[model samples]
Target: MIPTPEIRHVNVTRYITPLREGGSLPAVADADDGFKYVVKFKGAGHGVKMLIAELIGCEIGRVLGFKVPEVVFAHLDEAFGRTEADEEIQDLLKGSQGLNIGLHFLSGAINFDPVVTTIDAQLASEIVWFDAFMTNIDRTFRNTNMLMWHRELWLIDHGASLYFHHSFTNWEKGAQTPFALVKDHVLLPQASELDTANQKLKSLLTPQVLQDIVNLIPQEWLEWEGYEQTTEEIRAIYFQFLTARLAQAEVFTKTAQDARKALI
Candidate 1:
């Protein structure tokens, strides 16, 4: 069994206010290092679900070779006075007080927009495709959890995905399970532009890289009591996803290459 990360105590001198707020996970603050990390509390409430979802989503993003913020789960040791349900959440908060949860901080360095481009359409298409393959449903126009840095698109906030697993009783991983999203998603911004981008991804998302990405996730994170089963299940699903995606990649590559030639 892998050991859990050593929980640490932190002194957040100044609580940098959020640029925006709402949703289960609130945007916390950008630290002195210039990286803006979102601080979210874990308790016997809705935020619990969000925290779990985000951890899973980021792991998936890492596998697909996207720039996800370095996520470290930690506890908020500081006091913010009191809120409405303060007493009820206190124990869980105290238990979590130096213990980790999901992402610890957000780097304010990078920012991105799905509707806009300083980022190439091909790269954007891959980001969308990656999200689709991972079953991420949060990157829509209303709440695109992505960032733009150095004119590059950085993907984030995947805590809203794999809902089928969350509500497994209501949803089945049927034949439609695999490519269902691919057909409907269509790699936003059109396939015509993304044709060339796929080629770049072929090299970037090699099998070794995929394995390494999965390895980056601490084993303890997957071992969380209730989530372990789903973690293994998702791992298997992703294995199949990667194999199928890559098996057809050669053909897809050829198609893209041909499409690129036609455009010229």
Candidate 2:
């Protein structure tokens, strides 16, 4: 069994430059731990849901044996970004004063290029299964959201995952539905072991594993701008959603398998 890892909290020591590659305007910041982290602010356009998704998605990937960056609860004080010259950045920091999400910076990591690096069948199948299980719509060939560090592929930008939470309604249907976008998954063509990945992964995402990931979401994230539910209520919804989804794992597995066969 893969042990559930602890998510640490850190204080932002300094705000570095913005990583403009992503739409959310994540930044490179120094933490009190003396390490650099790519921090995602709660003030971004997508709101707290993005941060919640980031925490849960990355945790799931980590538990599934993927090489994911360490996720942290980055505390941003009211005066954190006041020294920044950019007005836009100042506003972003002001709105994100409490807790945000950050991933340890993988320095010198280059974007994964399909032409230059090859992923084996097992890994590809697992990745496809993971994204599909979570309904992640971002990992397409147009923008793989994967990186190569020290010759090993690492996942990033998982804030687009757990898309069902964006609506937070009809979760039963959401859980029951198969992911139609598997056809566009960047790894689908190479995911020949979908059945194998399915059997192993289903057994790994036990009830305990799902609850641990849901528990990582900060209460502040649950208290977004215009929501009317207690944090515990929101948390319960997420856990149920995941539990229902996992019970129907084969629904998505078959979809991904068919998509791969069509590609071939």
State the lDDT of candidate 2 residue by residue for 104-197, as single tens digits. 9999999988887889999999999999998899999899999999999999998998888788867788888799998999888889999999
- Candidate 1 residues lying further than 4 Å off, grouped into runs, are 1-15, 18-20, 29-36, 44-49, 59-63, 77-98, 101-118, 168-187, 190-264
Candidate 1 accuracy as lDDT: 0.50
TM-score of 2: 0.97
TM-score of each: 0.58, 0.97
Best by lDDT: 2
When summed lDDT is taken over every stretch of 10 residues in candidate 1, the lowest stretch is 1-10
Q: Write the per-residue lDDT of candidate 1 for residues 1-264, one digit (tens) a residue.
A: 123223233433333543344444253543434444665555434444455556656755665567776676544564632342545334544444443443455445454444454455656567655554456666655666777655555676766665554544423342124433333332353444554555555565556555544444334444445543566665554444454555555444444445434544
Model 1, residue 234: distance off in Å is 8.9
Q: Candidate 2: where are CA atoms >4 Å away?
A: none
Deviation (Å) of 227 in candidate 2? 3.0
**Backbone clash tally (model 2):** 0
lDDT for each of the candidates?
A: 0.50, 0.90
